[model samples]
Target: MLKKLTQSETLAEQAYREIKQAIIEGRFSPGEHLPEEAIASMLGISRTPLKKAIEKLSYEGLVDLRSGKIARVAEYTPNDIENFLQLRVLLEPFNVEQIVRIPISEEKMSELVELVEEQKKAIEDNDLYQFIQLDAEFHLSLAKLNPNQKLQQFIEQLNNNLHRRYLILSKTLEYGSKTAYEEHVSILKALQKGNPEEAGRAMKTHIQNVENRIRGYQASSLH
Candidate 1:
């Protein structure tokens, strides 16, 4: 079955997906060196495909690849996540505030409504991966309502980085996916009501709560 799936994709693409999944699942620990030979041997592929896969992961910020250096899974510490969240605290809240002020169109509004509904269903089904995916979608869709292309791209990068880090911590952190979904619903409600103050406040609070959850976990773990 796996072979059949690989048939539709190049060896490099398949290797990329496999390695990426391993990194996200914490099978490949952060800063873990990935020797090309061993990874190629494990995946039953040649070094060339494995190298290409590592480079792709490098581009996505999941792997660190340098010429003449062995690839290592990217290390994102709590401080690193806090850095991303800090920027997000600035950008995302402003984006959503502008979105609320402009008053999103019905079409875009409906898109958000559908995304939150899907998010709720994912949580009910206990599908963490799907829920994470929808969480990014919800934030990105809201950012897309803004007309500034650069702003949209910037916000997308922030969201993607946060999403990837979230996946790495997934195994250790049972950080209430439902809490996030509920916060998203709060932001959406403010948008629906065309209240920029409430929307911005809700967005800010949601981002702040993310930092709180991570810190809370880290604190508990030290004990």
Candidate 2:
């Protein structure tokens, strides 16, 4: 399977996905060094592909590459987190507006609903990782419901940068999942009503709630 993938995808693409998944799941903690040789050995691939993957992740702002040194996960400052949240506030509302004009299918909408429900179950099970992953998917799916490649690219990039920070915050905030599920319900309801304005408002508030909860977590973490 790995060799077949290498023929189609450069070894770098495979390495990139593996490294990115590790970062998202908190296996590679933020600010931890990413030794190319170590990763290459673990993935059972060559250093060339691992190096390529590190370069790609660095370009996406998910990892930092020091000159002549190993790559590491990017550190999130309070300002970095705030900036990410602000960008989502600015761009995603517009994306939601655009999606509202298109005819969204019932099946897809149900998928979004199920995503929220899945998060609820994950929360109940104390599975923070799955909750965070599903939470991101729910929001991204909304932006992707429309056929705008540019918007999709932008959101994908934004989510990559912000996803780790969200995972950290999720561990500290017990109410995060339930609150997110409720907000998602509101957004879905607006979509069902075919009301773009309401949907947009719900999304903005949902994102802002994430910001608010993250801020609270930061404050608590300080003590």
Candidate 3:
């Protein structure tokens, strides 16, 4: 059963989160029309809050809204996946390069190490949702090393768009969590060594590996 939102200062935000989680968990399949009235009733909210939630989801690329048509879950193609991956390859390495230029505090380094260890445990337990969240945190933590707020925002937006894609791929691909954890370890090790170039290279390779996996999955699905 769908859960009702508690009375809050940000009802729209709450609605957005619930709907987004439903989409991520495959409760709403790709390209299926989102029955706004049904969902609003299920969540015990009015269409106004639900509409606001849908708008935010659309901005995040998780929902499609068009003129004279109902909103549906966004369907991503292989080309769309490749394009997003390519953008990450270009943007994330540059963020790594910036991290190398700056000095990382001992406390921050310790926090990053802890996150990796927690992620390893998540993988061991086969907790896909926790693992995916930690994966985003790991990269976003590094991206935050950049001094530029604009760059950080850009990275955040990109990750938000990719979150659903990652969730879907993780379910379909057997090696998704294991390989991602291993690659994350490699990137962290390079960062620990203060090797910017090596860290950048590691990040680039990680993104490329993910791209390849997604492309391979798409091909297999078509066969």
Candidate 4:
């Protein structure tokens, strides 16, 4: 039988979730200091438990610690983002291909549909933060369907690294949120049909569109 979480475990998990959510929502921007004291106080927990949470975040590649410097959020370069996208394009499609052979449960499909609706609402309301959150959650939940804990964990790390940078990119572009919603719908439809090829193509195209837009924006800002 599986063990239940105790009080300390629950507190630490809560701290980790709150801190991770804040980081993903860009409440803590790249290279911004994450003071243990401040974070502990903010989460209403002792430094010890908060420290444990920070360590967990660090293991997930979301937090960075420097000698004689406070820990800060990790920043991704354009090349880093590109590399990540390439890896995702390779891995996720294979996972989706495997999924085609298995029947997806109705409950899982319904949950994903609800997530898509949430993303649509966020876009319509221009809630970029919430839009981004639901977007990441949608992808993370899809990967979790694979039943491979290690693979799911790796994908979560990749999503965390991309989430902030993607949000930054999305904010500067015209109609980014709208485009994302549309693309998500396309991907969802392909997944619903269990067409791995179509789903993979849509996913790749969506990511590529964001990448192109971000590069264009970056270049224009420099000019």
Q: If scored against the real structure, what TM-score would every candidate get?
A: 0.84, 0.74, 0.84, 0.72
Please give, for residues 18-41, the per-residue lDDT of candidate 3 as tens digits.
877777566888888888899888
Model 2 lDDT tens row, 1-223 = 1222355677788778767666755678778888777677787887887788888878767788889887888776777777788889988877877787796788987887788789889878987657767877887787688798888878877876565445453443344768877888898888888888988898899889888888777787679
Q: Looking at model 2, report the run of 10 residues with the lowest lDDT sum.
A: 1-10
Off by over 4 Å in 2: 1-28, 38-49, 52-56, 163-175
When summed lDDT is taken over every stretch of 10 residues in candidate 1, the lowest stretch is 165-174
Please list all clashing residue pairs in model 2, or write none if there are none: none
Show how many residue pairs clash in every candidate, following the order shown. 0, 0, 0, 0
2 or 3, greater by lDDT:
3
Who wins the lDDT comparison?
3
Q: Measured by TM-score, how close is model 3 to the native structure? A: 0.84
lDDT of 4: 0.73
Error of 3 at 107 (Å): 2.2
Per-residue lDDT of 170-223 in model 4, one digit per residue for the tens?
A: 343233778878888988898899887888788888777767766776687678
